[model samples]
Target: MAKFKLFKDRKGKADQAKNNKFVKLGREIYVQARKGGPNPDANFGLKTAIHNARQINMPVDNIERAIKKASGNGENVEYDEIYYEGYGPGGVAIMVKCLTDNRNRTAADVRSIFNKRGGNMGESGCVAYMFDQKGILIIDREKFADLDEDILMMQSIESGADDIVTNEDSFEVLTHPHEFESVKSAMEAAKFEFSSSEVSWIPQNMVGVEGENAEKLLKMMDAFEDNDDVQDVYTNFEISDEEMARLG
Candidate 1:
């Protein structure tokens, strides 16, 4: 959910590590294009990666360069997509997504972060059962000032979206992984702009974290995010807005 601790600030915000974000996004673009070819129209994953790049204001030149590299112009070395599951402080389930050239190095990096911060890295499928891969789309409330809530719901439902969620500030549309593109196209056709869109590992339930454990967990998460190989990190932990503000 958007209210989840890390995502609350991440949503509609510029990434803190811009250069790392560029590398991560570029690698994803390259992988998708390499696997499915440079044509986004025929490759759903590449199309989604491109949309995500634009959402973060990645330069068009950077995106094109990545495509070219992936399309046989550059080294074209394969990067492996790996998932590392672990438990953070206070039993918080953590799932890390990575694109790496070296499995041993990535595994060691992830394991060290877990072990250093009162966490335990586990075997594959360790905590993955707690999450679902869902297509999430965030719509800024101010962007479509004239849109009615009912109309938005109708469009989302008819477009094959799985669920609609809302907060005081924005609307979120969820869709199955297979239906993501069709739903996104429908929303775009209706002129609805998204603040963010991605197929991510969404936690099925949330765990509460506070006090020192929360502090340690945040540090651990920061370590993971700062890793060049780490692409995305998901955790089941949640903290109140007040607690989050205080952490700041």
Candidate 2:
């Protein structure tokens, strides 16, 4: 199993958990409604979004209000989902995913962050070829004590999943983009409690950063994640457990 040192400590989890769920839910509603329709039951993406929002303890009222707002007559905030590729310290490839109403504003903000962090943003397709976009489903381990790993794996494979990884705290299932819904439904049928399900870019190869370079790269990643417009960030960098402990 490949362990990501970036998520080693509980500090990031605690900090993110404090973020206002209303705001997050609002963004999700906006994206889903804009992409599909306001009705979650009729829209698979919207249904997934709402499910994920609830999983994070977002208030029901907030979720409802967001849906209502999206359906009602209002200034439609047109969000364009954009991805930026760049190289951080030690030549670690980084990909940032953002949803913004203005592409120019988002691009400038991303570029500024990269520049400040001693990194440079690259042209489109520069670093993207090094990654594969896949649907990832994450589930909490405590929910299923008697869970049959082999059975779950076989079910996922039959439902179009490409791989499965079980960790100490969670189980991550990977699937093709088109089969995401099917695989997710299979897991749900098996009574699995999903923590999150989304399409993300996974790096095919990883770079090893150490010493000063690793510190700088981590700081840059933190800054990118803190941006309001930024939704997700992916990188192909591997850090050892010892490095994670020292940083933590």
Candidate 3:
């Protein structure tokens, strides 16, 4: 199985990075609620938004405030979902997801970042072809110290998961996008707690990056995540664990 790279925080920035994630999640909840009513039970998008927010440990008060702002008649700030494809250092394919109130501003900002950071933004569907959307559920090892990996794997497979990848500190259950909900429900029914869960873009291949290119790419990623309009950024860059430690 290929080890795909997902967006992650760089060393020494975990605190600010997590807070940034909460802001993005709050925006997502507000957008989803405004688009599909505030009721999570009735609105699938809103429900998923709330789930993602909770996955990141977003505060309950913040979640409720976003929903309230969306449902109430007071504030009206419509956000548009936009995706930008690009190439970062070492020719690694990149995909940026954004929720913005202004298309032109977001596009300009994204393009500028790409231009200045050893990258080039491309048209829609440019690098999107290199990725497939998949659902991932991560279970922490310490959370269930007595859990058997084999039994958990068997249960996940029976529950519709396609595969289970064991990492040093966690178990990652993979599922087809269509079967994600059923598998998640089954695991929940089995009392399995998830460290994190999401339907995300997975790269088809990995492109190795090192030295200056790796540094440049990491900076580019940080730039995108720091943008208020940007939500998520995905890439196919593969940096060795050793290189990552050195970079840190």
Candidate 4:
């Protein structure tokens, strides 16, 4: 198995730092509600999105307003979910998930970024084959010091988890997409303080990039993440701790 690079702790903060999270959260809520209904109680994805927003300290009023706009008579922004695959610098496979009302606009924007950044957008399924869809659960390490790794491993295995990784400050539980909710519930019932849990694309392998090329790739990813139409961006580029500290 490839060593899972801990990007969440560093990249997550940088990615969501620009006050764009709320807009992204609103868009996700709108789409999830449109797909299932306004009630978070009935929609798992919506509930998860709401949970994520709350974890990030998003205002309650903003969350309520998003739900209301999604359910009530409002300017219905019909967003279509799309994924773009590509290769970034150093042959790193990249996957860009987007929710856009206008495909043309989104495509042009993404294409321009790739072109300028020494990357190119790929055909459907071109780069997706290098990744797998998995349920990822992240828990704060400080709150679970009493929980033995052996016990957690057994619980995860029983819950159909594929893997468990303990980093310096977090526990990452990976499971099949179908077993995500069950494992999440199990951890919650055990009183673990989860920072976030969701299904995401995990790269099967990583490409190591360093120095200026690494910096450029990171900037490209940042630009893509800043786009309102983009929902999530996954890449196989691995940055060393030295690079991360410098970037931070």
Cα RMSD, model 2: 2.6
Query: Considering only N, C-alpha and C atoms within 3 Å, which residue pairs clash in candidate 3?
Result: none
Candidate 1 to truth, TM: 0.91
Write model 1 residue lDDT over 143-243, tens digit each, in one string. 76676889889999999999988766778899998888889999998888887788888899988888888888877877776788998888889877787
Q: Cα miss at 237, model 1 (Å)?
A: 0.6
Worst lDDT run of 10 residues, candidate 1, spans: 2-11
How well is each residue in 122-196 modelled by candidate 2, as lDDT tens digits? 998888988988898987778766778888788788778999988887888999988999889887887766888
User: Which segments of candidate 2 are over 4 A away from where they belong?
Assistant: 1-17, 20-25
In order, candidate lDDTs are 0.85, 0.78, 0.84, 0.80
Q: Write the per-residue lDDT of candidate 3 for residues 42-68, one digit (tens) a residue.
A: 886787778878877899999999998
Better of 3 and 4 by lDDT: 3
Q: Distance from true position, residue 248, model 3, in Å? A: 2.9
Local distance difference test, candidate 2: 0.78
Candidate 4 C-alpha lDDT tens digits along 69-170: 788767777899999888777778888889999999999999888888888998989888888999998877787677788888887787678999888988
